[model samples]
Target: MQTCALAEELAADNDFILYAASLHPFARADDQELSEKERYEMIMQELQIIGRRFISQGLHVHVGMPDGETAIKVCNLIQAFLPIFLSLSCSSPFYEGKDTGLLSYRTKLFEVLPLAGLFEYMENWNHFVDQIEDLRKYGIIGGIRDLWWDTRPNPQFGTVEIRVCDLPVKFTSILALVALIQSTAAWLVEDVEGSSALSPYLLKANKWQAARHGLEGRFVDPTAILGDHPMQFRLAAMILKSRVSPYASKLGCDSYLEHLDSIISGGTGADHMCRIYQNTGDFHQVVRAIQKEFWQ
Candidate 1:
């Protein structure tokens, strides 16, 4: 909250307020603002497609793990829950001054970059290291930071970084997401046998559904024995089955996890923005509403 207050004060000094939406609702795509950092310069020079679209933000939660192996295990175990997290935090419903008809349009924009989106399965720490080594050897990427996967094992931080969520509008929403992610990580660590072996195809499909429809999306079950007739469920239902409350209680974040129930019942950030636009019929009003509600 102090950081946000500082930012708000700074922006106020400059005659601008802090706008916390994932994507700029009205900025033109070609209006570029390049950073002076070498890596950012390389991104603009090499990947010419990334312009203002790359300016979008996300809420990345890093949960600490005991070892590299445990980080990899947690990354794999947490893959199935990424879509649910995205749905809960959807905030980029408008892009280029227009309603995009998708909850988290920022997800689609980020996926346009190379090495982005869902990560490939790794058998172990050794396998992950080998893959990164090969990518570096072939000049495919300069380092680990280049691999912008939805979830990755950050060896330097000894943490599993979940990069799937849009920047939610409310500060409490951010806290709730962090609590949920931390609780889920703890649960996964305690119950190694509960790891999900969901197919990569199913994971991608679920992510797409979440980006398109938020909590209203349907999730496909990978365990159905019927090969061509798998059962599907509402994303909210799948989220309830995750059973993270027990871990949250142990971690002393049970109250934060309870906010998830409020999010499910009230709607995501994107849903809130869309409603404001629908009522006012103006993108300006939508953005003003976001700015007003951000610190609430």
Candidate 2:
């Protein structure tokens, strides 16, 4: 199926699945999952081995925004929330049963772009255009091509593209993520400039927390200095509840919240995968199990 079709379908249910681009020859095309023993017998492996499995999918959400100012606002607000969102949506912790120490190894691979992480605050919409023009003028980088933030403006679709999620076994998770983004986008639209500003160091700290602790950490407020900030926590909750709840509910993602709860109670994707591998004493088996559940 076309990637757009898959994205739209997933959005309908707030779910997501792996979407392998044609560029990646290692990507599977409707390949079925093999049992752990069977995979070993056939010497079939995932992206790193003799054969590719279904772990190469990515969850990319497209948001059609008007212009650059809104994009900047949404990116800034969402940048702080990215860690929490990533923690909740994390699904791939082990590629082949070994503890990867990464909640979403897939996401780590994706962020290797030139424009990853919190972008510099572009003050005005005009500044956005002028910045790009200047970048092109000085040959600093390509035009508004791929500034590659966790979220970036896609002028072609007139939207912002969020590219930080791992492909879920089920598509509903991706849709939930997109709904969260869309609802947040609608909220940001109301505030053209921004509500408040936080130090860049604080925002980066939040990212580190997400990458390192996943769901276990009591996530620090990106706007706060560094320690326990109850107001920041409350404000973040309110931001998601008001901005994301309406859309998430509309997309039938009450279960999405449930999933987050399960992850919090048990562990993040990395934690659970590690537990599974250690308990089973078989790395290949874990991969096979993930493949069976993930691939049809």
Candidate 3:
């Protein structure tokens, strides 16, 4: 909260609003007052054709690893659970004064980018390096930094960066997710079996469900030890209760992990915005409520 307040204060001279995730209903692409070019610089001439109409923000968590090989392995293992993280952190529900009917509309908008969304499953560090080199050879990318996967290995930092979460309205969610990612990474590096690796198609399906329904949607549990697939909340609860809580305790962050229970039981920031909009029929109130929560 102090960091956020300080950022807002520092950016005050630049007319920044310090809003999280997507823009509010008041700002629309059709509005003449809005300038897309002013907000972002085009990375490539090819990108100019797309026109930056949609804007969104995400919370990226970096889990440190001992080496690039371990980071690659950890990133591949972490992809299956990215959807759960996304659902828990869903915050953008309203777009241009109306409900988009999606928990994280921002996720949909973000995946439109050429290199965005779930990454193609790679074999190892060598495979990743070869693919990146091929992209660079074709002038498709300048460096490894240009590949924007949902989870990517940051070779320079020796960390697997998870980029599948929307910026949560509550600061505590950030801490919880960071702990979740850190703990999960630590666990995956412990020589887990190949059964933990789900197909990319399955992971993508879960990602879609998470964006559409947050924690309310049912997910296909490919590795389900029991009969049927469980709902998002059920899987999330299982994770929190089984692994995250114990790991959090070890990391001295059990209290932070506890916040996930509230998010799962009640709702995420997107749900909160939807309720506020339904009550007042005003997007401004939704924005105000989010801002107020940030301060509190």
State which candidate has the highest lDDT.
1
**For candidate 3, lDDT tens digit of each residue in 1-296?**
68887887876778765666544655674443323573245453456534345655689888778887787777777776778788888888877666788988888877777898877767778989999989999998877667778999887877788998898887777777677777777767774443445677778888889889988876765445222456665466556446655666777877877777777777888888888888998887877778767644
In candidate 2, where is summed lDDT lowest over 10 consecutive residues? Answer: 18-27
TM-scores for the candidates: 0.92, 0.67, 0.88
Query: What TM-score number comes out for model 3?
Result: 0.88
- The pairs that clash in candidate 3 are 25-97
Model 1 ranges off by over 4 Å: 194-197, 221-242
lDDT of 2: 0.56
Between candidates 1 and 3, which one is better according to lDDT?
1
Backbone clashes under 3 angstroms, per model: 0, 17, 1
lDDT on C-alpha atoms for all candidate structures: 0.82, 0.56, 0.73
Candidate 2, residue 97: lDDT: 30
Worst 10 residues of 1 by lDDT: 224-233
- For model 2, residues 168-255, the per-residue Cα lDDT tens digits are 4434444445666666667556643475655677666666556555665446665442235623322343346555566556556545
Error in Å for residue 237 of model 2: 7.4
